[model samples]
Target: MSDKKNENGISRREFLTKGALGSFLVAMGGATVGGFALPKPTVSPGPSRRYKLGDPGKFPVGTAMKMDKENIFLFRDVEGFYAITAVCTHLGCIVVRVDDGFACPCHGSRFAPDGHVVEGPAPRGLLWLEVSRTPDGGVMVDADVEVDLGTKLVV
Candidate 1:
């Protein structure tokens, strides 16, 4: 309240104001340094989503093979070859092949052989991935690419 100066020749109000300003400047300096010291925002690359399943002839017709590492089911029907993701749409759990369809062990979600949702808890059907024949006569499946339910690669 008083404008009287202390022994240091600075008034109480001036001392407080200077102290507050110094603190604010120091805090801002530290924040700026911290921002610069932090690593730059970046996206690290991930593993490729494409997988090569050797010779289409190796897969017998009517064969439904599960690739555990890839989390996909490769099917070779009479029509052609198609791939379905084994990951459950409900909670990302791996689905197991059942007698009539695929069943999720974690949440009881079921999907038909064609990847259609047969039970609830899952908001959508399984993902049908893009399958294509490579230049070398090998079959490849792209898990990152989604295709229509009935889409198949007739090699």
Candidate 2:
């Protein structure tokens, strides 16, 4: 009866359009606030690790054992004990120790017993982590810290 619609007399199209506009505005406002309120993602080194691998004497000389769960190879040569990462340098694939050396099944990368890359596609040698004896007499491998080549933990 009048040019102005009565209260509660909104057409379905008008109602939907207004609702959509309101939703869009609310979403944009929330996004703008969130852009400033949300914390920015940070690039940082991972936390330090000190993994205990039990008594050092458990590993014997001339024995090479793979701790698959820890992604490390505990080796005891006639000289001493050492640790080499089982992770392939090429694509982070876990390497398996063969008679000759370590091999990556994922991308055909090969590493020597000393963790040196003997084949292509690997950028560098496998990581040699820092190994030390804890006060509790357990052996600890610091995966977060890599030591120089030929570094050994002689028990």
Candidate 3:
């Protein structure tokens, strides 16, 4: 037997070096690619809560305004001040104000200004939220509470 008589006529040193290099390359590739295979963890939102919606004086009487951050529409009609959820009753999508009333972009759900369902698809009217004036000189919108559509905050 002779060293030159090794398998495929390759020396043991060359065989071992090539094997080690291939193993190292595979290990590096796995280390870099395997991390993204698992899905990332997500944090769920907390319970529905109330939030301050700013001063009531900001809105002029007889006008309706949308508070995008609060997801509510502040209305100050001749009757009184009230708040309606901007979230559509049909599919929880935010509704936008149209010439007649609110329109849901996710679906063709239409609601009257008073939140009454005016067209098909939407099963019910928009939600009326509890609105109140805080002693801290701000308007508070209680998301956890649902009030009647006729309810108003006489701010």
lDDT of 2 at 146: 92
* Deviation (Å) of 35 in candidate 3: 28
Worst ten-residue run, lDDT, model 1? 36-45
Estimated TM-score for each candidate = 0.72, 0.68, 0.65
Q: Where does model 2 exceed 4 Å of error? A: 1-48
Residues 1-155, candidate 2: write the lDDT tens digits.
Answer: 23345578876667778999999999999999899776665555565567887887787788788877788888788777788898888889999999888999999998887889899799999999888889998888887789887998877
Order the candidates by TM-score, highest first — what do you get? 1, 2, 3
Clash number for candidate 1: 0
lDDT of each: 0.91, 0.84, 0.83
lDDT of 1 by residue, 85-124 (tens): 9999999999999988999999899988787899879999
Best by TM-score: 1
